[model samples]
Target: MCAHYESPRDKALLKKHFAINLPSELAKRDVWPGYQSTFIRRHENADVGDDAVPPREALLGSFGLIPHWSKDDKIARHTYNARSETVAEKPSFRDAWQRAQHCIIPAQAIFEPDWRSGKAVPTRITLANGEPMGLAGLWARWRSPAGETVHSFTMLTINADEHPFMRNFHKPQDEKRSVVILPPDLYDDWLQAGPGESGVFLRAWAADELQAL
Candidate 1:
């Protein structure tokens, strides 16, 4: 699974690619499990017939999802990636998955460990076309003890044991996994999909579309 990634930093690029304008001040480009970053999702009021509201909106959220039942934000450290096989049954991810709180994590690249040699080496992976990646994820809201509302999200991952390119990542003995990289055409379909329809969009990306460096 991806534990680190480079979030897109160019405002124009984000606007042009995702169709949302972010704040002048942006989160750190390098995102980690508990770090804050931008994610795109369907606007809450999109169906309310409000012409003023755009269909999609961008917001800053924790990279790791913080479930509503959590006592604190520390749970983020372990909830950063939700396995697709158990996402609907996992306590930390079930609520969001069941509710279809889908989101898109725009990234320039994701880092994974290459264990081809005797030791681990960090490798960067990106789309072969060099465009930003719209990774499929789930978002959730949590209320802090201080009465503040926090937003968080987690990337959805699928088994990559049989994948041509992704099977080469991670430890040789470990079960290979890869994040779901959504195609541009399916962005709206993913965000609007219902719980029962999720299976339609959770397939692995084409290996030939990605390159690792």
Candidate 2:
């Protein structure tokens, strides 16, 4: 499954999506797939802009995780998402899951697909009013052999809520569900304020905060 996110504003276009901007000294300026994002450390880089120096939080590193153990460097492409279900135990994501939480790439809306007749149709999911949206994600910093630092991010997926409108996208709902839909109520908490698996938070979003078309 793939994800599509839009800008922080309420528009159907793709260019306006909010991507994390890095400081000029941030080292690597590489862009990500779909031209979607380049993640930065929230505590270290969140509030600072490129021109703004001495950012309150130091520039820790960029997203695209660099497993503290890998000596090869290309592992990032495969180590993106740390599945919420198995994150606590996975070697790649486990370390950051409970301690080094990173911010995710957010959007006003994201798209999924409905496959039928051996073809795929895209469906856009967003808030009825069109506010910014967030996906579950993990981040990492990779230091190039040259020592330049780059950041990267990954989108998390759980079983889709598959409202009557979006069900055509995947498979039988009773089987294995996969896609994580975040709701408005859980937005703040998931991003900066809650605790636990947050079932209450997950249910709220799964209920009605989304509209897929």
Candidate 3:
């Protein structure tokens, strides 16, 4: 259920790959981490993923999720999409899923599904060598009463089998499937270890990094 993704990628394709700088700080964002660009998450607390580092921070939230003893915001219109197997048991994401983690939603493509007969054709996925990839994130920080605070993010999914290129677009999921991509070297271990080895180093990466079109 990736929905749609493609973080723009200008500034010379993130300065020809990492070592970026030019995301001043929120100013009407979301052209896919826009407002300045260069977006990536996972580090609600840290536990691996190269310790989840560099040129990845463009928070301007609102992909659903506004928990913190919520009093409004209608359950974030459905709380975006969080299901890394129930995000540790979601109650607005169990303490940000064990102190929150898993990020990097930079991109090149993402739309999802060819579900076929029941409709939903769409399909996009990417990086079978097309480069650019990152997804699986969760971020939060809400406050406002006099001390404004608003940082939000969410994007994590699984279930999409056999990828010769995102398997003709995630065809499995009638139940028990796979989707979501990342692992070009743990993308920073998930945030940088700690939290009991960052969920076993993000379930161990190595899906050959990616090639899912």
Q: Report the number of the highest-TM-score candidate.
A: 1
Query: Model 2, residue 191: displacement in angstroms?
Result: 4.4
lDDT against the true structure, each candidate: 0.93, 0.49, 0.54
Better of 1 and 2 by lDDT: 1
Q: Which portions of model 1 miss their true places by more than 4 Å?
A: none
What's the TM-score of every candidate structure? 0.98, 0.62, 0.30
Candidate 3 C-alpha lDDT tens digits along 1-213 = 554566644656654553344355422223322122234563234334565454244444555556676665456556656777777788886666677454555667656666655676765556656666666566666674556676556666654444334444544555423435556566666644444554443332234555434
The sequence of per-residue lDDT tens digits that candidate 1 reaches over residues 94-162 is 999999999999999999999999689999999999999999999999999999999999999999999
RMSD of each: 0.8, 6.3, 16.4
Give the TM-score comparing model 2 with the true structure, all chains together.
Answer: 0.62
Task: Choose the strongest candidate by lDDT.
Answer: 1
* Cα deviation of 44, candidate 3, in Å: 24
**In angstroms, how far off is 134's CA in candidate 3?**
3.0
Which segments of model 2 are wrong by more than 4 Å? Answer: 7-41, 45-66, 71-73, 161-167, 171-188, 191-204
Q: lDDT of model 1 at residue 31? A: 95
Between prediction 2 and prediction 3, the one with superior lDDT is 3
